[model samples]
Target: MNKTKNYDLTIIIPMYNEYENMERLEKKLTGYINKARMKTCVLLVNDGSTDGSLGRIKDICERNTDFFYISYDSNRGLSTALNAGIDNTESRYLGYMDADMQTDAEDFDLLLQHIGSNQIVTGIRARRKDTGFKRMQSKIANSFRRRMTGDTATDTGCPLKVMWTEYARRIQFFDGMHRFLPALFSLEGANFKEVPVRHYPRTAGKSKYHLWNRLRKPFADCIAFRWMKNRYIRYEINEKEL
Candidate 1:
């Protein structure tokens, strides 16, 4: 793809040892780009996958004109990968989805409709395909987060989301920032809307999330978010001279 080409939306897919999923991801994302309602491109962030995922990502981007990527030498976690994507993209709008193929890239269109009014438009997985225990853990974590942050987002963890790049760039990146995007945006006084979207089971690549990261870490991060929220700074420019 022409690095200088203008794009209306850039979908950021964070990949961490997801070599098995790359083939399907390429097919789905390519199809989405062809029929996307807006001028769209894909930004694949390779987070130091020790596997041959980087080779696959390179090949995919090389074959597809709309695909682009950035990679680092060491694993930096999901938040770091996503932050890199946010900081690097030049598109007006940014979308995020995991490389697991659990969330459909085509659903970016649904979130795009609300971008005109909402600073962030996120998807709430209507029928999740995870196991019972995983679902329960998510439910509890979400409840706790809502109580702490007061963000009314039903599913902040849903990978499918779209937001203005400006607001996305302002988010305070942290270890668990991916799980708190709605709350982080709210801290910047950005409006958010959640719409239900489709979800699927992971057919390839082992799930990266475990009980510790999904439940315990989020508990710790929620307290940290509260502490930061109390001292968070916000300001507006009444006027400026060029």
Candidate 2:
């Protein structure tokens, strides 16, 4: 049986080829968890990094307090990592962030403040520190996605996010689900809040996304999301017998 945690929240960080960011990630997260408002723990989900990051993640988790890790033998991409994290989370609330060091871990307190009666709380990266071309591409993609999914997410790709574990586990798993989490959560009639969070330029590690995958892939996934929206099931029982 999966061991259920007594912590108030579990933060799940998914990593791929993030060997260079591991040291800074540990420093940042360790400092954040020490002062966070809730009793928080971190779970590092390694999606089969070939850059020796898997070993580094193991090492950090061993030394850091309330840090745990799980890894895949092969690279399975972001969606798989998220699903696995949800499946293993042993807490009432599950938060998510990237290992790229682009977003601040401290802003989790801001997101947590608004999670009351909300199934999900996500971040909007304020003053994004990216190339103009990269920003433009993301803006276009987010606009297209909002039109397709009818969700009011300002930045669906922002890696900082928090959600109730029950609602997160209810999400329908799909190949590109990470890009459509807000829409999928809403499809289940769950409430979510979006808060602005800090963004920073990456100091290390190469980004895994490129023009083709960032733009074209999400476009296709939006269509898939539309199809799922049409067939999604919802139900309510007025009463149940013991």
Candidate 3:
């Protein structure tokens, strides 16, 4: 018998003024999760959206049994929104996707399969649908990050990922932290993997990031991470005697 004890997965979607794409986002996400044959639920984090996104999120959560939402009154960056979702979730596994719908939701199942052995597994955009300029910017930023942090995982900015809830909670995040997930996980000494996943073009709602914000911010953060990495204290406690 398939026991319906509780949800096994919590999918967190961070939204910021995405009113135009809210309904479609709900429909597509719910449909994919249902088809995946897992006890999955959604956690919509409204990052201080000025539009009617929060109301729509509340309405959907109220009407749908497996959907839920929480919001902040003021705008915080993606790291804070994601941290809020991580702190709020009560599930065995945690998943993350952006509100832009650039990545396929079904890929969560693919990532979920690898979560047992690995604390984190992320999707790599096989064929990114973003513009040439955006792609170039991402390439430069990723190259710099790899050199600085030495995480050595391609496509860290893919925006779709699954992580064990424990590992997710253990992450020490700060501003612009979303870009360095794999690096941070490595710092925690957690196993992580990357799998190829499909990518799509943004159909509605404009991207919140620009060239400066996306690439330059990460560049600055890379310098900060270098400092933190050298000063980081890692030790092993062999046995506990009480």
Residue 81, candidate 2: how far off, in angstroms? 0.5
Candidate 2 runs further than 4 Å off = 1-4
Candidates in descending lDDT order: 1, 2, 3
- Cα lDDT tens digits, model 1, 41-144, are 99999999999999999999888888999999999999999999988888889899999999999899999999999999999998899999999999999999
User: What are the per-residue Cα lDDT tens digits for candidate 3 across 1-242?
Assistant: 21112678888999899999988888898798778757898899999999888899999888888888889999998999999999888788889999998888888988988888999899999989999999999999999999999997899899999988888888877888888898988998989899999999999998998988988788999999889888877788999999
Q: lDDT (CA) for every model shown?
A: 0.92, 0.91, 0.88
> What is the lDDT for 65 in model 2?
65
RMSD from true fold, candidate 1: 1.5
> How many backbone clashes does every candidate have?
0, 0, 0
lDDT of the structure predicted as candidate 3: 0.88
At residue 222, what lDDT does model 3 achieve?
97
User: In model 2, how large is the Cα lDDT of residue 120?
Assistant: 92
Off by over 4 Å in 3: 1-5
**Residue pairs clashing, model 1:** none
| Candidate 2 similarity to native, TM-score | 0.97
Please report the TM-score between candidate 1 and the true structure. Answer: 0.97
